[model samples]
Target: MGKSGSAGPLMTLDINRFNGVPLHLQISEALRKAVSNGQLQGGERLPSTRSLAGDWSVSRNTVLQVFETLISEGYLEARVGDGTYVKRQVLGDFTATSATDERPLETKASYPFRGLSQRGKALIAHRLGGLTERPTLFMPDVPDLQAFPIRSWLRLMNEVSGRLKGDILVNVSNAGYEPLRDAIAQHLRTARGMMVESRQVIITTGSQQSLDLLARLLVDRGDPVWLEEPGYVGARAALMANGCSVLPIPTDEEGINIDLGRSKFPTPRMVLVSPSRHYPLGGTLSAERREELLDLSRTTGAWILEDDYDCEFRYRGQPFAALQSVDRDGRVVSIGTFSKTLLPSFRLGFVVVPIDLADDFAKARAVIDRHAPIMEQMVLAEFMHRGLYSAHIRRMRSLYAERQAAMLQLLDETLSYTPPEFECAGGMHFVLPFKEGVDDTAVAHELWKDRIVSRPLSMYFSGRRKCSGLLLGFAAFRAEDILAAGKHLAGLGDLIRRND
Candidate 1:
């Protein structure tokens, strides 16, 4: 009863221009659906490509490509003289009545195998806080990507790329590029006051990988590991992923409570601390606590992981010498990353292990990823060797200090109350504590809706006593943007009032 060839059925395609799908693919899919649904009957001829293009407001070539694709897929056939037609074989036993009458078989969705392992589930449970790939306003620990020295970096990259030859390409070191290790060791000796040797330094993808590698290599499964309370979530995730039992040790203005940890979780296999400047809180570990921590490690035979992230960005006075610098024994494994000082995407970080563990760590590094990219290492080595890396750090320190000052001034003028911790000497972010009854997570969620990114302080805690607050980052934001976002933040005045 239908016409042998018709364009009427193809006209109601419901093409969407705003859904980000390609026009040709959309047209092809619509045609296939029409044939499958029996809306277009078997052996029904389609309109000419030009006619379809004009009707759909698409190019003639788009329609032609769509026809060719469907023909190849056997959904449609093309004749020399006649126009395109739906393949009758494709509709075998698929009559117009059957297409409408036959329903899809009723079946529940089922997976082929068992679900994730317990370790996988634990890793998911301890996952780090949400962070957008592209940095947003007030996103903590993100550096100013726009301010990176791309010109100098690209020049170094070009220089390195040109030098890549037989041995450079084929004979990669398991430890890392040697010159880069030399540069890092030299920098640590001068800048961080750590007496590290190039042979002891092993390059990793980043600090996250460094933590994971150390966790798996240093500790056995179910070994107790002491972590700073309200500590780095990534560290917690890494340790838990390796089946380590995380023991949260409370911290104060001075740093991790050494006495409290010894009294409670006494026999930890390892102790991880951000001693240079405690993350989020900006508290420097006291000299006494550092000694105590080292003593604790010595007596207990536990390894100490010093996460010296963002140590180079200290705004005022000198940061304390690295914990590794004071380690009498080689029990301290210091991890450093360019993610904070340089670009996070560089994926370059290193660990200064004890002399005995260097070869073992290098072997593990080889097993994991066979070392970081060669060209990047060469470029970074050149950059550091030329003193450009230190120069960049100095520039970023001044810029971040100005931004921090601007943010503090904004908060002071806007908010009803300001916490004492807001006057921190250095660090990328400041924690704004909320009253006991206030839900910091809910407040953070509401701020996100207003295009202001913040991490709820409660999310950082693995222990029972969780503090409710928000970590507001200023390092990556310009003064004007910080002011603009601060206005929105000020609107939540009562919501962020201090508990005291």
Candidate 2:
């Protein structure tokens, strides 16, 4: 066993034949430690695999395997006509410092001194401010996961999996799976009365991604965008993350006040609104306000983003058509997600952009994540095409309607707390407004401490017109569970009194 060339120094490696460890693993670990401890300096040529194998009394394949592992992990590199060398700059200047230095290496000092960009700082500061996925009582935005049609879904998944061919697996359009886009387009046309072609449907990871995409593609940094006050925190966060100057417009019994938005930010580049059913506050945009908002978009060249989320669960007279259905000017970008209807883990949502913007949005989406998983998209397309999606939605809608009524009644009975005015239509959650001087955030925190996950309504607002209240969800829990939680909620009056 000897060195293969005169270019590299001879080295000793400790090997135990009877240590019960695989030689390959021991060799890899030893090399890793050596590199980490600066024993193997960066750019230092290593002995040929043949020579190392001879020196260690191992096969050439073993040395080759070890080298391959380190090379794949970026710890080592092989140069043609030269030899295997420790990778340079893989972990900064670890090679530049001599291994025989008198002082010990300050590992922490090697960290790069960098700061987040302006947009990154903005994103970090704008917290979505909500609870975790814990199945706590009164948690908002969580669907009844147990009630989802898993058996049917699994059957469809299997069928799709079996039928997936080379084209289905390897070939995917950047927008999404074409069949899934067709399914979404058809569903929107039938359910929400939207006029959309499959080409306009750009599938996204979820509603958050949709918002972020819109923020990125439509507006630039410091551009003005109007948001509904006491609205969805997620939309606000996404807009701010893109460095959009978010101007909060107030909402009333009617949806967003178009007049106020115009008065404050006269010409914002875009406006994100939940016109079908205002989130948290739960008010559909009045017909007049819809017209006014559309007119504003047409007049000022502003793009209106209609978040028609949770419109599938309306318990009222009839579900309203999406605002885009009435927009003849092609200014509306309709967004929908299955998170509230199906499970949130599905991570499937779609954005229906104007025909002119569709190409750019798809290109941008391709850059963001290439596209969502094709297998799930195929299964969902099959699920929708077979009419299972509608049936599941109808079942969950009915069930949540019952739970909503039961929760409202139980809250009244248990705590003698009933809002004089509240929207009893669609939406997974409802807001209970407190009078002035009550610390709703403190109340929410206290309830959370007791395992009740209620959100402070004030947390949804960034403007001066903050509403103090709690947003309690009823869609995820049973009537009995809500009542049981209501019993605990009844005793929390002392805490509210203390906060007051």
Candidate 3:
């Protein structure tokens, strides 16, 4: 049980007798032995309760008690806010018997890490702030909540506040609130055509939290993770941070190509895709490709993460039902977010996992952030029950449909003959693939000067591929604005067509 403080990240424990001796006691003994034996000398910060929860396969409360017991015993120090750090002084001095030898790094605090050390800042830095401060287009993912049904929300919140008994309010389900999950299950079934029970839905703080939870649960270091070539960059960053080797899959007009993904990065354990509508590209996955993916998952025992990102605003005919509806093999984990559907800042989303993995996934979530903000969950549930969510979505659908039409007409009249192959099927954004070799970054840079913000296709690549396209989100923009931006991009589009 000696913890080579800097050795392996986890310490294995006997869990077969879990129901007997409290888990914290076992953990305390294991940690104390590691320190006394000098395997763990000093000054090592223990993994946060969230991190240990995943490793021990136990609750955060269990780990919390373990820390408290060890701290009281002088074996560990609870620094409170900054997390628990191992006190090297616990063992007095291990090198007191040895001749005093000092190294340069030893003398210097904040020494640069030797390449292999875990203390180094990650090699692959995350690129962010794309739309974090109000998307360049000035319309971000969140709706102006002030314009939403705030009065009705406040009334229901007041009602929930009044009804909450002390014990009922204090209690929590490791997965989430049961009534909220049931409400979400019903909402998905009636609105988005997904079939699942409340038991399958695990609520989260937006899709980012869902990605973090999935990485902790499924991915080991360097496990192959396949992502769309021109996809959401933030998702890639999340997977990479968890030590997954991300492989990029090229997209055609009909969404992610299954044959290409399987042939290219064939050994990946998980494939992430936005099948309902291709992200940025904004095309539905052809039926053939959808079946091919499910077939691949069933045959290879791989799990598919279907990000049903923005199916709510179809703006056309009935949007395709989620891919999980037919995934009978328990290989699909469907994630959806209200970030775009209602508001982004609300940061409420859920993952519909197979029933078996639901408990473990919740354990992983509890490890990360104990249940999402309860107040927001309560408000959303009330919104759904009082029929405001449905009405709001219906209103947004009509508004976005008009905006998309106006933008398309503006494009046809001002710039190109047509946009990409997909036509307003569903999504907040659509792609206009530039002629090959047309630097999308340069084009976007030019657009930025005019305050007409457009995302370059190359930015989405996993630092691979010579992709040239522009991703323009229409839902966030008003008709007049998209019209004006189309005019500016047209001035740039002419240069492309002429070069062609």
Candidate 4:
């Protein structure tokens, strides 16, 4: 006869140290509850430490320690000639009853349904991310896998790993690997003309994570925030999920209309912009507009989030400097991602915050997820430190320039259809606008039937004056491939036009 009562099954205990309580204390508390609740009767012989160890899936020494602790507190007793038993004095506080007299605890129960929180509902309503899962031809924002410098990257990884020590492996900081932050800061100084320091950089998993962190840290529920019309969907979704009242400001050839934004929603708590090069539409925010936005930030005390995604792929004359470079008042948070320049799977990005907010953001990041993988950070740091990162970017830039030209050439040469109009100088994808009345979403779906995947421009807009177009990615495809894709598109154009 084991110590377990016949009327009930053996006691079950789950031990996980990650629950923030010590292992011994958790076990002691569970056993104490069994005694106090009359589940274990007075003078009832308890299971041996070995028996309890087997049942609880814990070490015998751990169970013995728990037993020792409980015995010292008078909840359990030990007899020299026999095994341990429940202390009569402790059990006397409760009525002596068989285990059968007490109802068994149910792990689960049915209850009336309740609604989710408002934020939960907002998140559900505006779903984002997962854009790269089923990548097809012309999928926007995808890097050329064939052109990546895998050999150089692998060599750098080997070099970094060979020199790695215990301290580097275990001493991961919430701010990120210091050397990597330094590398990013140095790169940004020359690349985007931003005066930043390593300490202000907070490494995140991706741009999506950067957005989420900013939403959690700065945005308050129901606070009005300015977002560009036909803007990045991920930004809108993140802000909405945090319960921000999003104000969609319209855009033009020179980027977001600052005067219109001022007229419509003069004061917002936050404003998110892709200033260096806007996504999908591919417009650089004009210098005058940049000054206006900085002035607005200064006057209203509204925070400006500059998403400098894909700023390196500019094929035109010198690309504009980052908007953060002009904000002397530390109100701008500049975000950049290696996901566009490097592989998205790398999952590395950084946010440069004001020096005053650095420590708080670091603490907040630690509470969210400790930090990004240490080894990857080390490898990338070495990659950049050795100048391989800049070299890779230059190579990809040349290759992408060729691909972009090829796509444009094919669109112009294809005789069966009219080429879409474009005004932007650079980005990974080019906007292909359709007639005003045509639904680009339907055209994109029809193109998908021919295995050509392109994002509809209308999908990015959240306002009434939505444009109709397709965002065709050229950076990932070769010249020959782009021409082939154009042929398929031209062939499908007639069918689509006939149906229309």
Cα lDDT computed for each candidate against the true fold: 0.85, 0.84, 0.74, 0.81
lDDT of 3 by residue, 192-235 (tens): 67778898999998898888788778778888988887788778
Number of the predicted model whose lDDT against the real structure is largest: 1
lDDT of 2: 0.84
| Model 2 pairs in collision | none
Q: Answer with 2 or 3, whichever has the higher TM-score.
A: 2
Over 135-233, each residue of candidate 1 has an lDDT whose tens digit, in order, gives 788888889998899999999998889899978898878999999999999999999999899999999889989999999899999999999998998
Expressed as tens digits, the lDDT of each residue in 27-81 for candidate 2 is 9988877776678788899988877888899999999999998888888989887
Q: Which scores greater on TM-score, model 3 or model 4? A: 4
- Clashing pairs in model 3, backbone N/Cα/C closer than 3 A: 42-88, 142-344
True-structure lDDT of candidate 3: 0.74
Shift of residue 194 alpha carbon in model 1, Å: 0.2
TM-score of each: 0.79, 0.79, 0.72, 0.75
Evaluate residue 490 in candidate 1 and report its C-alpha lDDT on the 0 to 100 scale: 73
* Model 1, runs deviating above 4 Å: 1-109, 128-133, 419-423, 497-500
Ten contiguous residues minimizing lDDT sum, candidate 1: 91-100
User: Against the true structure, candidate 1 has what lDDT?
Assistant: 0.85
lDDT of 4 at 33: 72
